[model samples]
Target: METAMSDIKIIMKETYSKLVTFKRKENRESFNKELLKVLPQIYRYVSKRLNSAVANGKLNKGMFNPSDFTDQLFIEVYDNIDDIKSENELHVFLFKKVDELLEDSLVEEEFDHVFFDNIDTYSKPEWDAMEENYTQDGDGDFLLLEELDDSSLDKTNYTLNHVFITDEEKKLADKLDASLDKERIYNHIQLVLDKMNLPMRTVFELFTNEGLTTEEIADIRKTTLDQVEELLASARLLLKNSFEKRFLIDSN
Candidate 1:
């Protein structure tokens, strides 16, 4: 019987300790002090309520675990302890729990607000210097930071500060620069002019006073209509030959 009583005492102490420790990771010294104050209050409240059960041998220490105590507390004061059939009883019940939460002596110090303030306040000059160092690139222009011009859809309207050579133009230019012969180049230019078929413009440039037509050329050359047609055909062929010699004969 003595052994049973001792075991019951141990169970009460262990269960109460577990409730105070459960899910609490704050200051150990403060928590233990607060818990010490809470345990006696809980013991008194439970003991008074279960006096009949204890006498009847129904209320055992092993059955009253930390979870069981928490459950009982929840049921007791859940919808206002005043509704628990007695005013003085509910007052004493809640007063002890509230006292445990608000015990000023148990808390040795307030939260470190100065440490938080120091973290919030930073040196602006130091930040500015660091930003300058971070952004420093020895290059003349920061291409990445260039703003896109949204004003025009025409690609030619945009000017590249650096010489821009397209892949196709670059390749063709490179090949021509390496291999093109002088005669071939000259012929190609003449061929292009011939293809333009602007005899009136040429006549205006060469002899400002004299006006000439295709018929006049035929008469001067002493050719029939059919012969004139053949001569024009031959002229076209000669122009094509000249163009091929000048331009089509590609120089490296």
Candidate 2:
């Protein structure tokens, strides 16, 4: 137990280190300094998975890397979008190929070795600290989905409207409602992006350009208003969350 506690403290320290380093206004300057350390491994895995997929032809050449579509990915893509988008699509296409391979291959074992192996080393206490410090920001600007009134209107409604989807989008959105992990929605959005094959710039342009109502987004997606509301609610949770994670709180 003591060893576990010590590991937890290390996790907490590392998590806090990332959090505090990111809190600097010039975070962009320091961005990827530490994060880049872990990215190559992820990048390599994605590349390998993608290369195998291209050989299998299960995916188009332009699929995005759905597995690696994290906020960190956004930062990486934002700079050289053309290259990144193409790479992402190829990566995603490959991911589909690998998904097919999973049926016959020991992909689960590989995943366990790659991602899940050290995950157990992650202390729940460290995760709690990450949630408390990295997400909640020692400041109080953070708001959970449950904290928002279902009836309330905010800038977030516009943000949610941007995630275009069909009836199929609802199931993923529902899963997101059940669990507020930003990572889940991030992955779901990547899935949608893969389905649409839309560029990040195009999506970002659409999201920022037009303001959307909960009603309008629902009509566009052909889903019920309630479902749209749920989607929007989940989106709001992510928007605020991404902001807090990437920038310092602006509670003023």
TM-score of each: 0.18, 0.22
Each model's lDDT: 0.32, 0.35
**Model 1, residue 183: what's the lDDT?**
39
| Tens-digit lDDT string for candidate 2 (18-101) | 534464544654544543332332333343334333333343444544233332443542343233233223223322333333
Query: Residue 49, candidate 2: how far off, in angstroms?
Result: 2.4
lDDT of 1 at 37: 32
